[model samples]
Target: MSFRFLPDDPVASIKLRPGQTVMVDPSARRGGSCLEVLEGVARVYCPCEETEGMTLAFLQEGDQVRTDRLCSEGICVEALTPLSFRSDAEPQEGVGFDSVNEWTLQLLRIRHLGNAELRLHALLALLVNRLGRRCGQWCDLPFRITHDRIGELIGSTRVTSTRLISKLRNSDQLDTPSGDNNLRLSAALIESAPVLG
Candidate 1:
C-alpha cells in the first residue's frame, strides 16, 4: 500500500506491512513538515522516474526525514520491517544533522575501500554499529537485508555478496537462522572492522 502526506492533516500516523511503500509528496506536505519513524525500520529511496528506487537510507525508531529537503519528485519509504511513522512532525531549528546524508556518506566511504571484502566488512560494521545491538557473543541486527541489497550497498555483484556472506558463515562470523529474519555477526568480526575504528 502507499500513502501521501496530506496538508489537511496537521499530524498523521501511518503503519505499513513489510515490503509496502509510502510516497511523501513534497508538494502536498505542509512547510516544515517531517516524517518521524515511530517503530521498526524503513528503507527510504528516490521516487523520481529517472532515479526511482535508488536506496538513500535506512531509518529506524526516532529517525526523522525532513520533507523540506526532499527533491521535487519527493521520496518513497518502504517497510523493511513492520513500520510506523508520523507524517507531521514539528520542524526543528538548527538540528544540523541529516541521517540520510550521513548514511550516504558512510556507504560512499565503504565503496571506496580497496577491496570488495573490506567494503563488505565495513558495510556490515556500519549497519551493526548504527542499527544492531550486542547480545552476549554476537551483534544482532533486527532485520535481514537481501544479498542483492548488500551488494548494491557495497558496490559488488550479488554473486560476490553471496560468496562473501558464505565465507563469513563458514568462518563463524555471521549467522542466519532458518526460521528467523534477523542476522547475527560475531563480536570479534565487528570489532575487527577497520572502517569504524
Candidate 2:
C-alpha cells in the first residue's frame, strides 16, 4: 500500500477490489464534482429523485460532470468506472466564502460598477460563465426549473427569469430549449446573438 495525498496538484490513483464501495454516506455533503475516465465508466444518480426511480448520468473517458452546489443529493452517483476522484473542496462556509481570495472580491466589484450596460453584460457573462458549458461551441445549460427557482438562486423571479432569459434569446443573447425535457442550453446561440442590449 503506497499512497499519498497531494493538495497542490490533486490526483487519485487506486485499484479498488471489485464490488468495493467506499464513502457511501449521504450526510457526506458535496459541493461539486468533475470526473475524468481513467479505466472504466460510471453513473451519476440524480440525487433528488423521490423513491420513484434513480436517474443516472453516464460518463465516459472524455466527459465531465458538474453537480449543483447545494446538496442533499438530487444527483445520486455510482461508479461505473473503478472510480478515482480528484476533488477540491474547502470546509463548509458557515456564512458563505467571500473572503476566500482576491478573485472572489474582484467578482463582487462587478456587482457594484454602476454602469448598466457594463454591469448587465458583466453579470450576463458571469451568469453564463458560471452556469454554462461549452462543447464544440455549444453550451449544454440548465433549463426549465421554473422562473421562481431562478429568482431563488439570484434574487430574481419565475417571471423575471423567464423575461431575462427570454430577452437574451430574443436579443440573441441566450437560447432556451423548446420542451421541458430538453432544457440543455446553448452557448453558441449566446455567441451567435450579438452582445447589444
Top-TM-score candidate index: 1
TM-score of 1: 0.90
Q: 118-177, model 1: which lDDT tens digit per residue?
A: 998988888889989999989998889889888878888999999999999999999998
Q: Please count the clashing residue pairs in each candidate, in the order shown.
A: 0, 18
Q: How do the residues 68-134 of candidate 2 rate in per-residue lDDT, one tens digit apiece? A: 3323543333443355543333333353432213223434555455443344345444444544457
Q: Give the TM-score of candidate 2.
A: 0.33
State the displacement of the C-alpha of residue 45, model 1, in Å, after optimal TM-score superposition: 1.2
Error of 1 at 142 (Å): 0.5
* Steric clash count of candidate 2: 18
lDDT of 2: 0.40
